[model samples]
Target: MERDKGKLELIATQRVNANSEMYKVVDFLNKSLKNYHLMFGLTKKDESMVISIYEVE
Candidate 1:
């Protein structure tokens, strides 16, 4: 899951909150990403999160 962490890091950039729960981060990313020309695939693994992005059609 190291690759998934990298993906989240790239996506979140400097906006990541160190104290927030993974679910909260996922929710925030979900709303913010919806405003762009991209779509996201989110999966929760216990207390961690995995995000996948795809171009909008």
Candidate 2:
């Protein structure tokens, strides 16, 4: 039905937006890592606290 088609289109558009946001986040992280000579690793204290070290160049 036309209603189903509309729902599918909305879902597709949402997926596209999510993918675009993911790409932007990845790009930003990559640029920051490169610009700062940064190193990142998982911390033992907690799973969420990722440790990132950067040295001034």
Candidate 3:
């Protein structure tokens, strides 16, 4: 995760077959932190999954 000013970027890697709980967590955090959470992408490579997120004021 990286933070700059009022923006935050998060890159989370997991198993491709695993449940994607990040979506819910992101939603919760957005409300909790009073910030907007934008989903960048979800990429899959072999057995690995990548979740990209951005939080902005």
Which number leads on TM-score?
A: 1
Clashing pairs in model 3, backbone N/Cα/C closer than 3 A:
none
Model 2, 1-57: lDDT tens per residue?
Answer: 234321211111111222324445545665767555443322333223333333333
Task: Write model 1 residue lDDT over 1-57, tens digit each, in one string.
Answer: 234322322332222223446556566766887666454555655555566555553
lDDT scores of the candidates, listed in order = 0.51, 0.36, 0.54
CA shift of 40, model 2, Å: 12
Q: What is the descending lDDT order?
A: 3, 1, 2
TM-score between candidate 1 and the true structure: 0.38
The candidate 1 region of ten consecutive residues with least summed lDDT is: 5-14
The CA lDDT at 15 in model 3 is 43
User: Which residue window of length 10 is worst by lDDT in model 2?
Assistant: 6-15
Q: How many residue pairs clash (N, CA or C atoms closer than 3 angstroms) in each of the candidate models, in the order given?
A: 0, 0, 0
User: Per-residue alpha-carbon lDDT of model 3 for 32-56, expressed as tens digits?
Assistant: 6553354344565665666655544
Off by over 4 Å in 2: 1-18, 35-57
The TM-score of predicted model 2 comes to 0.28
TM-score of every model versus the real structure: 0.38, 0.28, 0.32
**True lDDT of residue 22, candidate 2:** 49
Which of 2 and 3 is ahead in lDDT? 3
